[model samples]
Target: MGRLIRPDGLAVGERVRFDGQVRLVLAVTGRSVTLSDIGGTPRAVPPALLFANGDFEVVDSSGRMPLPPVSLLETLPQAALERALWWEGHILEVLNGLPPDAEAGTEPKPQYAPSRSL
Candidate 1:
């Protein structure tokens, strides 16, 4: 668990719930975090609201690469880009763990219940 002082340490593209709706981190600055919906519409988000529900990581975003390259993140201010990239790599490291060859999404699939004959 992360502290509010660090704003939950969320990385871009990591799954998180805000107001009960899942959102993606488009950008993060020293002061605020930017979130986007599936439609890519962005909104200014405060760090305090990010973890208020203790609902960080509602879904494991580790399977896929999250967020756009810094080049495509035109919405972010120039100064925040480098830091965002650094944070992005750091988050991936933590989520990925120590095994370099480990598969990203290895969670066992759920088995469906067999249907009974009517």
Candidate 2:
């Protein structure tokens, strides 16, 4: 229903929805991508899974991505970064009645919980 973005098009700090939560792209390599939720817990995944999983979609993206903090080119502003994380927490709370990445929340739907389904 909207423009589809390929895995290779993802950029660090971009917000995406996957696995029933908001996540941020931490790093992207030719073979894999590192993603983190609002809690900053990182997960490394093969690039193809980002789109193949069918739950993946870019939520927020600017035409240009800022350089990682280690880079000298440019860094994302603290305010903007905070805003993204803030939204993740807010979304999680609204969806599950718990804080972002909290240990306890509403049980995930069988379709969304891989171990509970196929």
All candidates: CA RMSD (Å)? 13.7, 14.4
To one decimal, what is the Cα RMSD in angstroms of model 1 from the true structure?
Answer: 13.7
Across 1-118, the per-residue lDDT of candidate 2 in tens digits comes to 2334475477777878877787778798989888875535589888777766667788887632332333321245878767755775664455444554666646655444435423
Displacement of the residue 93 alpha carbon in candidate 2, Å: 34
Residue pairs of candidate 2 with colliding backbone atoms: none
Each prediction's TM-score versus the true structure: 0.43, 0.46
* lDDT tens digits, residue span 42-63, model 1: 8877666665545544454565
Whose lDDT is greatest here? Answer: 2
- Candidate No. with top TM-score: 2
